[model samples]
Target: MAGDAEGFTDFATSCSGRLFRTAWLLTGDWHLAEDLVQETLGKVYRAWTKRSRPDDPAAYARTTLVRTFVSHRRRRGSAERPTDSVPDTPGGETDVALRVTLLGALGRLDAKDRAVLVLRYWEDRSVEETAAELGLSAGAVRSRSFRALDRLRAVLGTDADDPTRSGVAR
Candidate 1:
């Protein structure tokens, strides 16, 4: 019992930051990302306590986070509340602007598309791994990756050359 607790603690300590980043990409809101990570940890912990630890706990956690984000977005109350003004954050002005631009562009994507982009590009997962994680086939993952990149390029108004010139601060 004690060993399981210690192992879980170690796992959480090692994996939480990456999981948090994934959550942030999924939700496009820091607060919601925090909530998603906590929910994922709880679910994983429960499964761990039951001695049903997955062969790859990190992958399991990622899968759980993505699924949870999708389910939450489907809720009626998940409609984002509009705010009149942007909240300020302590950062270099250009950095903040770039992050906001990127997140806004990501938010425009459907949940699955966003997930595929994050898993493939951000997390650097292979097509087969991403397909398994998202319950998709490799062909589907490849197709979605192609379509999602195109949509993101369109949303950001980037052409084939110098794609980063989307008015998003480097």
Candidate 2:
């Protein structure tokens, strides 16, 4: 009993940073990211008590995180659709600046597409795992991946299908 408690405590502590990072990438707001990560941990804690034979708690937590983000996005609807703050080009920014630009570009994409891209590129999940995680068909994952990359390219001021660009666009 004490061992399980300590194990979960350690798990939560170690996972919190990563979970928060993922949440921030998904939501793009610091406060919301904090809230979402807290909520995800709360959910994971609840599951830890009842869910047995849990293969990967982090994976389960990630799925819950994505679902929570999608729900919040749906609730916002049109309000989130307009973010005039993003710039059109990379300009004279440094690498961190370029990352910010890319993240803002990701913000313009559909929520599902954003999730697919984040899960694939950021989290580095394979297509099959992503499909299973998102409850999508393998082909559907491919399509979403394709379209999301295109939108990301357009947002980054690059041609979506230009082979000379990083494979992220082509």
Candidate 3:
């Protein structure tokens, strides 16, 4: 029991940063992202305590995080605070304007659409894998992925002349 608890702690410590980043992308608010990560960790801990460990714990945790974000979005008060501009992080590798624009566009999407985009593009998941995680058919996942990309492109003001300018891959 002690060893299991220790292992879970180590797992959480190692994975928390990545989980928090995903949550931030999903929620588009730092505070809500923190809360979401904590909630996900708690859920994972409980599942760890109750059942045998999953073969791929990272995948299981990511599924839990996505499901939790979708569930949170369903609540009446799930609307996020709006920000006019992203704060400049000194020496950050990513472009702040692009990141903010992308996140703002993602925040506008419905929960399922956002989930599909995050799971498919951000997480680099396969269509079948994303479908299995979201409980959707493969065809549904593919369709949703295309629609989500279109919506994002519309929000980001993309066009044939500069489709790749948004930094979204084809």
* Candidate with the greatest lDDT versus the true structure: 3
On TM-score, the leading prediction is: 3
* Residue 9, model 1: Cα distance from true site in angstroms: 1.6
Q: lDDT (0-100) at residue 52 of candidate 2?
A: 71
Q: Model 3 residue 63 lDDT?
A: 86
- Candidate 1 residue 69 Cα shift, in angstroms, is 1.3
Name the regions of candidate 1 deviating beyond 4 angstroms. Answer: 1-3, 76-99, 158-161, 164-170
Off by over 4 Å in 3: 1-3, 78-90, 158-166
TM-score of each: 0.81, 0.81, 0.86
Q: Candidate 2: lDDT of 117?
A: 89
Lowest-sum lDDT 10-residue window in model 1: 161-170
lDDT of 2: 0.76
lDDT at 31, model 2:
77
Residue pairs in candidate 2 whose N, alpha carbon or C atoms collide under 3 angstroms = none
lDDT of 2 by residue, 94-167 (tens): 45555666678888888899889888887778999888778899999999998788778777775433531443
Clash list (residue pairs), candidate 3? none
- Residue-level lDDT of model 3, residues 1-170, one tens digit each, is 42389889999999999898888777777888899999989988887776566777788888889898889888737455456554444476566666667777877789899989887777778999898888899999999888888888787773432633345553
TM-score of 1: 0.81
